[model samples]
Target chain A: MDLLYQIFVDPFVQMGTAPDLLVQTLWEGLVSGVLYALIALGFVLIFKASGVFNFAQGIMVVFAALTLVGLYEKGVPAFLALALTIVVMLGLAVLVERLMLRPLVNQPDIVLFMATFGLTYVLIGLGEIIFGGDPKVMIADQLYLPRGAIDVNMLGGFVSLQKIDIAAAIIASLMVAGLAVVFQKTRIGRALRAVADSHKAALSVGISLEQIWVVVWFAAGIVALATGIMWGARSNVSFALEIVSLKALPVLILGGLTSIPGAIVGGIIIGVGEKLGEFYWGPLLGSGIESWLAYVIALIFLLFRPQGLFGERIIERI
Target chain B: MFYREAGQYKTSYAADQAIFPVLQDRLGLIAILIVAFVVIPLTGNEFLLQAVMIPFLVFTLATIGLNLLTGYTGLLSLGTGAFMGVGAYACYKLATIFPQVNLLVWVVASGFFAAGVGVLFGLPSLRIKGFYLAVATLAAQFFLSWCFIRIPWLYNYNISASIEVPTRTLFGIPVTGPTAAPVTRYLVVLSIVVVMTWLASNLVHGRIGRMWMAVRDMDIAAELIGIKLYRTKLLAFAVSSFYCGVAGAMLAFLWLGAAESESFNINQSFLVLFMVIIGGLGSLTGSFFGALFIWGLPIVLRNAPGAFGLSITAATVEHITFMVVGALIVFFLIVEPNGLARLWQIGKQKLRVWPFPY
Candidate 1:
């Protein structure tokens, strides 16, 4: 008992003097949580408007990031390169609406979902071929994010906060707030809600399905681009980010596909939970628990609250 | 016609209930079996049996498995690859622990492990439906895949985290691992696929299959008709997973002789899903036909450029393959949403009334 206490409990007791490592992990987790929320935002945008679970949203994050970095390397200025990338995402949105969604307007949800999976491969191959299958720097310094950390004293311990994390949190919050206003207060938001309510009725009311699709897709594109940038800054920007982007699947499950607020709350819950669990309790399981902890949490969450935190309760009547 | 079924009718209930009641179908099946069992072994080279035939057979089994759960039961799953991984790991553990057990016994029993996990994953289906259910199953995919990577004891803590297939044999014939003869391995895989396909077919044509279809078409209607949706759906998951488990074990043991988590990623799940969709939803023939086209097309794409006068790089071929396959999926959905099997049935119907207007 004395040996165990000195070996395990001593770290927490010593934390009163120095907690930089603990705070750093939490900071890292927050930045990643922001990126995850960004990817989940893209998924929620498409699902809310189209009722299609866009599995390709992860690839879209990679595609947009790769496009931005790939073009910047080709001599486009960083900001101009970012703009060009947005244009490319918009083009992708337009192309998808015209070529894929329009043709299968009333197809089964599963069919549409599968089509997005096909879209995923299309983007994967095309993005690889065009951008080259290599990880690149996200030009964090050029964007003036920062490279240092801030230390604050808490509970007789000093906690370190990275500038990149502060930037990510601020930027993500602004984007989420902006998106919330657009979804709630704008004319386009009303149209989107109407379309979401009933595709046939919205079409009957002269709301162009094509136009709404283009708008929502473009919105998803922006979300993807922002996600790519923030996530790129954390790790090197690369195609390997696809796996991390896929983490958003469990996040979406926790958040619910149809609720924007659910995404934010779910993102934080998973983010903080995974981070804390990995730091404190991961050693109990030999570490690497962070990798699948969110999923475990979501699985248990599904058992009790399958509707997600803010999602509409699905009730199927005979 | 020589293929006609005349003078071959069954007079007894037992005979009529045979797996292949039609004489021509039975004969055709026997001829196929003979070719696979005899001629291929006698004439074919090692490469054909190992690379193409073995993997194709295993994936065909998995496609059949997915077809049962997703196509017939209308329960969407994105965890097919993970389920297959469960089977492979389970088989590996079993074979290691039971050194004296026959290879075939271990393979068959490995499926029970996958089925057990599949049923646990399938539990959410009783309460969820549609897109929600797909999400739920994806949890199964990640959770199981996580188990393989994290649970060191499950994989015996290989430093590189990849399981190396151990050499094992049956009847003095090397059937798996590096030393295995290609022909012996092919026969082993072929035997499993043949018997399992028969089992799958029998199940699909029986009362259980009808109940699954009823649940798929309309769960409320199925319940109203006195079918217990919960028990039936779980059974579909278990049976489907058993087939996938055996397929996964075959893939690891017979085909690759080694595999990493990469082999069973979500991409693999998507490939099988596409096969089932392109093949057909509610048809056993669709599973076989879909597996052949989806799995075989890539090989043909990789090689066809070489046969032609033009030289195409492998990268370009991969790119072109994606574009072509993607277009075909959309085309299939647009032209005949019921898939390739429906198209085949239509062709058969057309052949019956050919050369004259009704």
Candidate 2:
């Protein structure tokens, strides 16, 4: 009975007593969820267009951040460095499409997936060599990202919110809205949807698979850049961020791999769930349940809905 | 010409179904075994035995473990490191509790513990497939790893939170612990690896392996053929984790001597998976090739600059090694998506038809 009370009753009581802390935890989760959603958006963009689950998405986030910070450290202005990073990402997309994707056309999805693992290694090596191993500041001040915190007094206490987190939430929503428009309205969008449906049919209709791959990969790279800046603002820009980006995987599974909106909703759900689990129940489990809690949540959800909340139902003819 | 098999004839069903049907292959196996058992151990220095060969053989076992599931069973798992940790920790606890039992018994038996954990995590496999399943396995990896750190009981309440292997003897010969000679440890690990590999070969070529392959090729079709999908997949997970568990136990007992949880992290899982895919999925022999390439290349690259009289920082060499390994993975995949096993097959084919285009 004591164990049951500890498991179920105590955490809720604690939350009720410290509602301010609860609000703070929720805010933190929202900020992290927005970041996770951004990373998952990059993954969804590439997976939908090419049917390739890009395992390097996490590393790409780190690499993009490192490049921007490295350039800024070398005395390039922030905006110019951002432009140069975008150009570099575009060049990377072209190179990948030509060198990797072209040769690997029609291979099994797993094979392509493994190829991305290779891409991750190469990017890690290159990034480390060029930028060095030391962590760098994200140059958020020069970029004019907001700093400090807003303290809200409510429920007999205070909740402090970081202005940067608010900006991140707003930016993420705008980007999603913009992406929705582009995906729904543009010619390239139709071409991407077509390629996503059937490669042969897309080709039959004169859609260039190679071009679409480049565009989508480039677009994912941009998303990765924005994610890097936001995440790096929160912490130091380093290879360690690569592991954190893997948090996006739970979000991807929860949201449905191919659904943009699913990524957003999944990200928030995992984010809030992770924070709540860590805050209320972590001590009972000896702490540090946050790492796997998201994955466990996704796994349980998968037992009931294998296709995910937004995923098309898998129809196995064979 | 000497490799020709035209005159060889099998008079019995057992002879016909032997692992190496070709006379040349049989001879090759014998030669390799002789070198492994006699020649290399006799001449190899301490570094070669301990650093290069022992870890190579250990990783080969782990790769074979993962190959059984991902390659043969068609389930892509990312939780191999956690499964391996279960084995190592289980062996540690069992050995401490029963000091009189042969450590070797506990080592092999530890695989059952890992197998249990693997099956528990693998329950979701029946509902999910592909990347979704892979993510599900990540839950196993992270949760188990967290448990390793958080549960002090698993480490026997050690202040350092590491498993220290105590000296254990077989036939009164020291085979483990800090006091054990490198050659003794090597021999122990090699023997276990060779026996496990042989068993794996037989298993892969038999009925259970075929069920795994059928499922891997197409689960729905496999299920239609009256094969129980859940049972077959869980069996694969259990068997795969069993091999990994034994490998993990040996990795700690015979190789590292003392190991922290850091030794069996996600990177270890990725390293074994790399070996499996780069070596060739679904081929036991390819596991060896994969282990050799992935493990040996770094050692070679690290030394190449020194041998060439070029002075470079150790960190730079490490970075270059990563770049080279990454590039080679891409190159090999582009050249032969089937992997190094296919290359070996192609080479054998060309050798069989030497001096002829066809």
Candidate 3:
């Protein structure tokens, strides 16, 4: 009976009694969720524009951040370093499209996916060699990202919120809104959607697959930069940030691989869900359930809807 | 012309269906086996025996295990490291409980535990496929890794939270544990890997393997043709986990002699996946080639700079190796999508038709 109470009832009762902790956990989850959403958003952009899964997105985040920090430490001004990083990412996109994608066109999905793994390896190697493999400060102060936390009294208790977290949430929303406008309204967006639907058909109608690929990859790169800045501000910018990319896997699948909004919603859901589970029921499980908790949640969701919440319904024909 | 298999005749069905129908191929296998069993040991290089050959064979087995699922059965798995961990931990638990039994038996027995866990995780495969399924498998990876750390019983309540192999003997020869001779450990690992690899070859070439291939090529179509999709996929999971389990057991007992959860983390899974892909998906021989390339190349590159009298730091060498490997992966994929095994086949083909363009 005591075991049952501990497993089922105790955590809820604790949440009710300490509502402030619940709110704080929720806020933390939302902030992390926004970050996860940003990463997943990068994935969705490339996956939508091209069928490739783009495993390099995580490494791209680390690479972009490293390039920025590495430049700053080398006496380059912050804004100039940022511009140079964007240019480098553009160069990377063009190179990838020409060298990797152009050669592997019409190949199986797994082939393209594995090629991205290759891209990931190259980026990691190059990033380490150029940046010297050390964690660096994100230069948040130089970039004017907010610091410190705000304490808000709610429901007769105080909830402390990181000012940087608020900035991250706002920046993520703006980026998403901006991406949505671009995807919906731009001529390139229409071409991208056409190419996404059918590569050959889009090409038949005079849409250049190469151009679209470069554009999509560049867009994904920009998202990675923004994600790096936010996440690196929270923690140190290093190769360890690559692990957070794996965290985005659950979010990407949960949100549906092709849906931008799904990425955001899925990221938030997984982010909040993981934090809540770890906080409320962690003691019963001996803590550290956060690692697999998101995957389990995604797995459960996948069981019911293999296509994901926002994914198009899968149709099979013989 | 010298390498050609042109005048071989098989008078019987059994002869026709022999694994090495060509006499030269059979001779090649025998020669390779002789080199592995007799030649390397005589050289008496402890580093080669312990570090290079043992781990190579261990990963080769793991790659074969993963190949059975991802390469043959068409289900991409990312949780191989965790499955291997299950085997390692299960073997540890079983060994501590029954010290009287021969350690090899426990090594094989540990596979059953891994298979059970694999099947449990694999249940989702019926509903999910592709990257979604791969992500689902990560649940097993992270969850099992957590269990390895959080559950003290897995390590027998060791303060270090790592499984330490207890010395075990086979016929009065110590085959495992810290005190075991490297040569003895190598021989035992080789024997296991060779036997299991032979079994894998037979399994892949037989009716069951065809069923697996059929499922891999098209599950819906395989279902229409009377192959049970769920059972076959689960069997692939079970068998794949079995190979990985044995590999993990050998890893702890023979190669590392001690291991923590970190040894079987996501990176291990990715490393094996790279081997399988770069070696050639769905090729048994490719597993070996992939293992040797992925495992051996870095070691070779790291030493080559030193040998060449270049003043490079170890970290710089590592970074260069990563770049080289990454570039090679892309290069291989671009040049021949089928991986190194395809290159070997092409080489043989070219050799057969030397001096003739066609």
Candidate 4:
């Protein structure tokens, strides 16, 4: 009975007792969730536009950040490096569409997916070769992202919030809002939606699939850049960040493969859930449950809803 | 001309149903078997046996395992490394527990443990398909990997937390551990891989294989046609994990001689998947070819610089190899998405019709 209480009740009791800690955990979760959502947003954009599950998105994030940092280290101004990085990503997008996706068009989704795996390898090798494999600090101060922490007195305890976290959340929200506006209120957005819905139909109506693909991939690249900056500001920019970015897969699962809002909500849910599970129940499991907790959460959710929260209902035809 | 099967005739159903239907094919098979069982063993040096051939065979087995599911049953699993870990850990525990028992038995038996875990994780495959199922398998991958690290009991409370392979003799000949001769370990691994591959080939050619393939082609259609999708998919998981388990056991025992959780991380899974996809999705022969190419590419690349007397640093060569391998994979995928197996088939077809353009 005590074991059962410890399993089910004690975590809640702790939460009730230390509300400030709970808030702190939630804030940290939200920040990480925003990062995860940003990664997933990149995934959703490319997946929706190209039907290619770009496994390279994570590496693209690292590559983008690496380019930014590597250029800054080369004595380029931070903002110019940032712009050059965007251009590099755009170049990458065009190269990918031309080289990988064009030839592999009409292949099975799995084949395309594997092609992205190849893309991932190429990016990793290229990134390491160019940037040197060591981790580099994100130029947050030069970029003017906020620093320090805001300590709030609440519930008889002080919950310290990192100003960087607040900036991340705000920037992530602004980016999402901007993307939403662009997606909803633009001519290019209409073409993207058309291509996303039916490639054949879009092509028939004079929308160039190739051009749209390049555009969508470039957009995904930009998202990767923004994500790289925020995530790198939180930690050192390194290839190891690619592994953490894989948390976005579980996030994608929760959010659905194609839904932007689903990606956001799913990322937050996975982030908060993983944090809470680790903080409360980690000791019971020897304290490294954070690695698999997100996956487990996603797995449980998958059992109930295979198509995910915002994904279209799957209907198969013989 | 030698590849032609013009005069061959099958007088019986059994003859018609033989795996190698052509006379040349049977001869080719026998020749390859002779090379593997006789020629290579007698001529191969310690380095060849230890570094190239054994790892190749080990990965071939693992590739076959992944191919069985991803290539045959249409279930894309990313937890192969973890399943392999289960087998390795299980083999370790079993060996320590029953010191008197044959190590080979434990290696084979460990696959069952992996199969059980595979089935447990594969339960989600019924509801989830495609990438979702892939993520579900990642759950298995991460969770089991965590278990490998956290549960010291699996590794017998070792300080380093790595499983040390105990010396095990086969008919009083040392086949594992540092004391074991590479040739002895190679023969043991070879025999097991051959037998298991034969079993796999037979399975894929038989009714069970058809069921898996049918499900792979279209699960809903297979179900409507009265092929039990649940049983078939689960059985695919079981058998695939079984193969991977044995491969993992051999990998740790016959190849690495010692292992920690790092040996079976997500990268291992991806590596095996790359072999499967690059080899050929649905061809057993492709598994061998895929393993050989993917595993051999790095060795060849690493040696090529020295062979050419290039003055490049090892790290630079390593990075270059990565680039080349990456570029080659994409090139191969573009050139023949069906994998090297299909290319082999095309070659054979061209050889058969040589001197005449059809």
Interface root-mean-square deviation (Å) of every model: 2.1, 0.6, 0.7, 0.8
lDDT tens digits, residue span B182-219, model 4: 88898899999999999999999999999999999988
Question: In model 1, what is the error at residue A46, expressed in angstroms?
Answer: 0.7
TM-score of 3: 0.99
lDDT of 3: 0.94
List, residue by residue over B130-226, the lDDT tens digit for candidate 1. 7667767877887677678878777778998978878787887777778988888888899899999989998988999999999999999899989
What is the lDDT of every predicted structure here?
Answer: 0.84, 0.93, 0.94, 0.93
Which digits, one per residue and each the tens of the lDDT, describe model 3 over residues A1-318?
999999899989988999999999999999999999999999999999899999999999999999999989899999999999999999999999999999999988888899999999999999988987778999999999999999999977999999999999999999999999988999998999999899999999999999999999999999999999999999999999999999999999999999999999999999999999999888889988999999999999999999999998888766
Question: Could you report the Cα RMSD, in angstroms, for every candidate shown?
Answer: 3.3, 1.0, 1.1, 0.9
Off by over 4 Å in 2: none
Off by over 4 Å in 4: none
* Model no. 3, DockQ: 0.87
Model 3 ranges with Cα > 4 A deviation: none
- Candidate 4 lDDT over residue span A156-262, tens digit each: 99999999988878877887888788788999988888888888899999999999999999999999999999989988999999998789999998889988989
Lowest lDDT sum, 10 consecutive residues, model 4 chain B, at B312-321
Q: Which pairs clash (backbone N, Cα, C closer than 3 Å) in model 1?
A: none
Which 10 successive residues of model 2 chain A have the least lDDT summed?
A: A309-318
What DockQ does each listed candidate score?
Answer: 0.37, 0.91, 0.87, 0.80
Q: Which pairs clash inside model 2?
A: none
